[model samples]
Target chain A: MIKISDLRKGIPISNDPYGDLAKIFSMRKDELIKILNDMVNKGQIIKFRALLDHEKLGYRVSALIAMNMDDENIEKVINLAHITHFYVREKNEKFPYSYFAMAHFFNEDELKSFSKKLDEMHINYEILRTVKNLKNDVK
Target chain B: MDEVDRKILIYIQNEFPIDDRPYLKIAKDLGLDEFEVMNRIINLYNLGYIKKIIPKLSKSYIEKYERALVAIKANEKDIVKVSEFINSFENITHNYLRDHHYNIWFTISGKNFEEILKQIKIITEKLEIDDYIILRSVKSLKLDTEFEVKK
Candidate 1:
């Protein structure tokens, strides 16, 4: 059993209580950790991170960049993503069909310039500018 | 069970209250005496549920940007120094070290993006650490206040 202090000290895999509807219930401590650990071992929870309000902090520029890569060379793209200071990897849910990536810049011109770099590589991609944020993907 | 008590917690989470009779208005809405309402909140706070009672500010009030999640492989020896240094930033609103590669996660709200970037650059240079990651949130869902009690 973890004390209230322990629970508060270490991060709970998630702050969203029902974020994973199937896994989280009214469990606590060992029971909850046991379930989370089991899921982790099974590769259910691949990554976890905190989500914060950047715009509230005055970050007005953000975009979702979709890049089409040769399926054979996807690993190269993923490696590049890890090193890029601003790019994050995600699955493309919509068109113009390709692997999805997202990043934020200081302004529209910066975003465009960044996209231009990908264009130079001849990577097929689409840039989706974020106008408003409504829901956070809490993981 | 009254609406006033429920709303008060919501208000507390979103922002601190800033009025002489913050409870008075709540009391009027609930059709209860002002002192009684105030006493009830005081009791709840004493029970260790809330950290404090303060005023809430609008989003526009915050003005800084750049943020990053830095994980360090330090032992108990340097944890205090690391936390103190990060917490010293006046702009840092939320700081927590979660269990991950980038264990140290902080939310910084400054007057502008440059101010936020300035803070991050200073930390990176001082710490001489480079395995940090910045997971900027793309969206923010309105947080709910429901607490889950374990049986």
Candidate 2:
């Protein structure tokens, strides 16, 4: 089994994976490449990508929208550029929403416009605006 | 952030090279100096535009772990204490304070549902928060967080 902590420490998000990881893990460059290739082939590591800060990218507003809607209607919301995550969640008395979506907007006006669209579509939903992100460990 | 920076961000966010000299490859493709490209990336990080450039784990790999989106209803007074308490757990990947009745929302993952439940129990008892809901993700419709940066 691979030690995730060690691997994470070796290959940070901002550093050069090949050179930095090899140096940090005390492995040869070729060996590190082979290991990374193996991991990719095994479907462990999908692809390397950059995680952008949406707030700095002009997305000032982020909210979690919960709704009890049909799957067909999801297409409408999915087309929106603001939507980041859309998932079908388990429903209960405490949280009666079945469909959940995470959206980010450039400003409140954009959010209002999106909300207006939802209102026009007659989709009953509850908006849970994220006040603060206490912890977000994308490991 | 300018046109070149936007282009670089879009490319890196979508398809980051896996080669040894990845930044050099990016420089070649963009017709810029390797050091310039690297410096721009560093600048982006310093400006807080880019968080990290890491490998995205496959869905199958992630499916090995049990995960759930937990919503906790903590009083406004104890929000900070409760947030700090929940954030202390390594299993908790995401912890956020939302504007709702069930304010504190977080995603927790473990080896199994039992382990996740155990963690929840510990948190509830310790924080004195009995009002909470664990909303397990039934289906992931869209998980992409890539944003198209415009001029």
**Residue B92 lDDT in candidate 1:** 59
Maximum-lDDT candidate: 2
For model 2, how does the per-residue alpha-carbon lDDT over B1-151 read when each residue is reduced to its tens digit? 9999998898888867777877888899989887878888878877878777766767876668877899988999988888888988877877889988888999888888889989999999999888899987676777787986867
State which docking tier applies to candidate 1.
incorrect
Q: What is the C-alpha lDDT profile of model 1 across B75-125, one tens digit per residue? A: 445656776787776555555444434445555655455666677779867
TM, chain A, every candidate: 0.49, 0.81
TM-score of each: 0.42, 0.91
- Candidate topping TM-score: 2
Each model's RMSD to truth, in Å?
Answer: 19.6, 2.3
Global lDDT of each candidate: 0.44, 0.80
Residues A1-139 of candidate 2: C-alpha lDDT, one tens digit per residue: 3445355422454447577767777878778777877888888887677888887788878999988766677888777678888877788778888888899988899999999988887889999998988775443
